[model samples]
Target: MQLNLTGHHIEITDSLRNYVDEKMERIERHFDKVTNTHVILTVENVRHKAEATVNMRGNNIFAESTEDNMYAAIDSLTDKLDRQVKKHKEKITDHHQKESIPLVDTEEE
Candidate 1:
């Protein structure tokens, strides 16, 4: 999966990039269909915000988080994305159960 990182009023550092990459790996492990991810980190006064959009085959998941620290915000943002990806994975999975199987009549013997 491709990761595009952007910053607003802040510089993208290697540590921050690596941190995001590590956190995002969790999501990729859960769902392998991720095509790309666009992440935007912004700093406004005392608030640090992290936002991301994950692109899949036929779905797009967006999530954001705000905190006093950039690392905390990124962590929170990835957690939200992880939950959404799991939910989406469930939706795409085949849910049909044993209802399709026909019962055999014991009286046939």
Candidate 2:
């Protein structure tokens, strides 16, 4: 997956980038069809916010989290994205099951 990491009021450091990459692996383990991911880190006063948008084949998942620490925010954001991807995957797979069978009726005399 292509990751575009951006910082709003904070600087993007190497350690921060590595941390994000590490957390993203968890998401990839769940869904491998991810096309691109855009991550944004923002700092407002004492709040640190991390947001990510995952672009996939048939769906787009977005998640955000805010905490006092940047690492915590990133962790939370990845967790949210992981859950969304799992839910979406389940929906797509379930749809196939629903359409797999057809019902028909025969008249008896």
Candidate 3:
């Protein structure tokens, strides 16, 4: 999957970028259909915010977290995104199962 990292008011360092990339890579094991990911990091006052947008087959999952550290924020955001992805996948699987299964009827004459 393609990962795009952007910063708002802060300059993104190599280590920071690498850290974000690594963290995002962990989510790939959960769903391999991820096309691309957009990550935005912003530092405002005492709050560091990290937001990530994951593009899946026909769905878009987004998660944002704010913390005192950029890495921590990214971690939290990714955790949230993982949960969202899992939930979405489960829903899709359930729907497909229900749709594919045909009801059987038994009649007595």
Q: Write the per-residue lDDT of candidate 3 for residues 1-109, one digit (tens) a residue.
A: 9999999999999999999888888788888889999999999998999998999997999999999998889889999999988888887774543445547765677
Flag the better candidate by lDDT, 1 or 2: 1
Clashing pairs in 3: none
Q: Which residue ranges in model 3 land beyond 4 Å of their true spot?
A: 94-109
Cα RMSD to native, each candidate?
Answer: 2.7, 5.0, 4.7
User: Which scores better on lDDT, 1 or 3?
Assistant: 1
lDDT of each: 0.96, 0.94, 0.90
> 13-108, model 1: which lDDT tens digit per residue?
999999999999999999999999999999999999999999998799999999999999999999999999999999999988766565875566
The alpha-carbon lDDT assigned to residue 78 of candidate 1 equals 93
Candidate number with greatest lDDT:
1
How high is each candidate's TM-score? 0.89, 0.85, 0.83
Order of models, best TM-score first: 1, 2, 3
